[model samples]
Target chain A: MTYIIKTNNLTKIYQGKEVVSNVTMNIKKGEIYGFLGPNGAGKTTFMRMLMSLVKPSNGEIIICGEQVTPTSFELLKRIGCIIEYPVFYDKLTAKENLDLHCEYTGYYNKKEIDFVLDLVKLKDTEGKAVKDFSLGMKQRLGVARAIITKPEILILDEPINGLDPIGIKEFRNLFQKLSKDYGMTLLISSHILGEIEQIADTIGVIKDGKLIKEVLMEDIREENTAFIELKTNDVKKVAFEISHTLGISNFKILDEATIRIYDMKASEGEILKTLVVKDILVEAITRKNHSLEDYFLRIINGGGMNA
Target chain B: MLKLIKLEIKKFKLFNYYKGVLIANLGFIAFLSMIYFLERNDGNIPFENFEMAMNISSAAIRTTFIIFAAVLIVKLIIDEYKSKSIEIMFTYPIGRKKILTAKLMIVVAFTFIMVMSSTSLMAGLLYFAEAQFDIFPVELSFQDIVRNVYVNFFYALATAGLSLIPLLFGMRRKSAVATIVSAIFLATVTSTTSDNINLFSIIAIPVSLGVFGILIGYLAISKIEQVDVI
Candidate 1:
């Protein structure tokens, strides 16, 4: 697939220190790419580079087939962005704010404003003043403003930073719907892994200004490592008995009463049978898998899964 | 470029503070008229009284005009800086210099219109009241009134121009309060003491203003182009 966004050795420095080191990333067209990282991990800096907000210290970014430069207005025209906290004029109504954004985007259609407002489920809030909006509502409004012009690519940095669960769900649903219906490419960064996992087609993990991993959702799911968790009173005895009896060693004792088996050869039934024979009454047995959060933390903590 | 200017103007309108400013200007004129009526003695004042009123009003209006103009300019620019919206704004399909120029132009244009409209309305009201009440027997000709109008026009424009100094400072400091205080301090010191200082007096205010504008413009362009917006 052709990449819509591509970067080569992109870097950013602040106060004689590199905030984003030499990094390269590729975002395919018509896919939702999730940028996962910790706070101040250079996610926002990368997005800014894509949008041409800050001049890259070295290297290049290509968005929508246009090379990003110091003043690449044409390239930026097709991109929508919310770098950090979405800020708008408090005195204006939602529609007025959208209208101002429309002017800058060169999309002057009044009908498009309502269309975007409805898309973000903010139709009823058209006339409500922005100052009175809740954080979630403002976030929804920020998304609405970003998509008002039907931009080809949406670059959102922590779009759901302060959103509640319901707001996050709504945003996920909105993003999924937009990607499916409009085929717009999205590059979103968020610390909330579950939300990103739910909607993103591809995942990128960033740490210390470097792209640690990039993989498709399907590939990650296919190669997913199963985590079989077992809880019993005698965790050590059970773990030793299971390993010795079944000849399986790819297991971890998660806690005093829990053992997590990563190997697939030791079937749950066979292991339970062996445990029963050993007189280790397992209180609970659960077939678990690595969550996106687990995967993110694993990668961040230098415990990355071999996907 | 025009579209971006339109967008910048929309931002100014969205804030709605400028509307209140217009209302305050009208209200101030009404208050001044009320005070004039309260103090007036029917058909008896000398020409010296009219001259005294003009002088006092000139100083008051000049100071008021300059402060308001600077405040409006600083408000327009500093708000964008404070909210980090400048980062978002500069990403649009417009040159950075063009965006700054548009914002500066809009603020200057708005100040000019408000000052002119408020001053003319106040002048018209004063002339009408004087005609009706015959409070001042000193018969001022149309030419004299027109000359005063011309003076008011130049004065208002000059006051508006004076704001450019603070605006340059505002762009550099990114602080509205700093712009105001610095502008006030400089204007007070320079305007008051220039006659005492032979060198300053010899240069003339207009010449100094022009030179300052060029230097400040250079500083603004350099600073804006290079400073990282985070």
Candidate 2:
């Protein structure tokens, strides 16, 4: 697997405190690498360092096999990003802002502006100044600006922060299209697990300035163990039955009314039949799958994802 | 580098600034005419010599245009840092020093050109007015007015560099108020006159201040690469 972006021992310190510490990560080519973290988790600082807007306190970043130095600004031509909220020459209209961006990014294709605007559904901005845009519109414009250059790598920090539900879905689809069709490697940062889980091929969870976990979305889904949950008054008897007669040792007693059986040979029908034969009052029984949010919290909490 | 400067101008819509410059010129000419009329009529032997009139006008020009340059610095430089937009610019494919140099070039060029043109315009108009209306008993040779223009050119160049001094104060805290206020303070200090001998007349004072201002500009861009935008 070719890595499009790689960092070794990356760190940033401010006022004698480490904001991001010793993070070594690799983002594969043409993949959506989700950077997951809560607020103040140093995600913005990390992205800024990647852009060389902030110098790393220690370590280095290599992009497309070239080391990133203070003067290696030409390397930035290959990347497009929105480190925080999108900012622009708000006094100018949207087209003018995009024009300026293209000029600075050295992208001479003026037609690409309309193409990106259409991609983000901002075609009829009505010649309005960017200052007049709502948060959602600004977010869309931000995406448009990031993709206008057709960069090799896209680093977006909370790119969908202010979008509505439908807009979020649209961005999700857009990100996928950009990664799939345009072959752009994307590193998108966000705190929402469900939103990222839907789009990110690989997930990296950052908490307290350290990356606690980095794994493929499929691996996390595979860890989403399915279990049988039985809700009844005699939880102890069911637990005993689950261990002896059912011959399943992988089980947990959550409370007096809940017994979760992780491994069961008998089907739900057979299990209910056995309970009924044994004169057990089974109020309700159902199969449950762990959500990715729970799995994310487990990784953040440092283990016990299966339990 | 020139392309970057043009892009900066286009980005900030700086072409619109011409309206303000025109207004300043008109206001300044009116003020000079008022002073000429009042000093002559108020029993003070107004402009006893050609040098006195030039000195007074140069002082006013330095004060207004230097502060005007500072206002531009606030708009084009300090405000971007304050709003964190410079971070975005730094991420571009251009070198940080080149981008900053382009911006300072705009400010310095604007200040120098305006000061020289305004001073020359005033001197020319003053000479014609003397020939036309005999505003005062004082006389000026053609050579004297021509020499004054050359002198004002140097002063204008010095003022261009001196105008950068405000960036020192403004960048320290990224405060627009601090930038404008410090500019006003510098202009007042340089423009204060007594007997046609202000600090600028000393020649050494303005020159050194100009050097110091250029030094500040140098210091700002020297380490901009390593310094975090935050």
Which candidate leads in lDDT?
Answer: 2
Q: For model 2 chain A, where is the 10-residue window of minimal lDDT?
A: A298-307
Per-residue lDDT of candidate 1, residues A1-307 (tens digit): 7999999989898888888888788999999999998888899888877777778898888887778767677777788888888888887899988887777767768898878788777889756899999888888888998777778899998999778888788888888887888899999998878788888999998888878888898887766688788999998898789778888888888889999998888778988889998888899888987776666687889834432
Write the residue-wise lDDT of candidate 2 on B1-230 in tens digits: 99999998888888998898888888878887888778768877777767777788888888999899998998899888877778789889999999999999999999999999988888877788888987657667878877887799999999999999999989999999999999999999999999778999887988999899899999999998888888
DockQ of each: 0.52, 0.87
* TM-scores vs. true structure, each candidate: 0.80, 0.95
lDDT of each: 0.74, 0.89
Chain B structural similarity (TM-score) per candidate? 0.75, 0.97
**TM-score of decoy 2:** 0.95
Candidate 1 lDDT over residue span B1-230, tens digit each: 56656666667663566576676667666656655655554543332444444544444454455566667667667877887778767877767777777776665566566667776766776677668876456775688678778766765565455557776667666888877876676556444432123222343663566457545644675546444677
Best by DockQ: 2
Off by over 4 Å in 1: A227-266, A275-288, A303-307, B1-10, B14-56, B114-154, B186-203, B214-218, B221-226
Model 1 chain B: worst 10 consecutive residues (lDDT sum): B193-202
DockQ, candidate 2, comes to 0.87
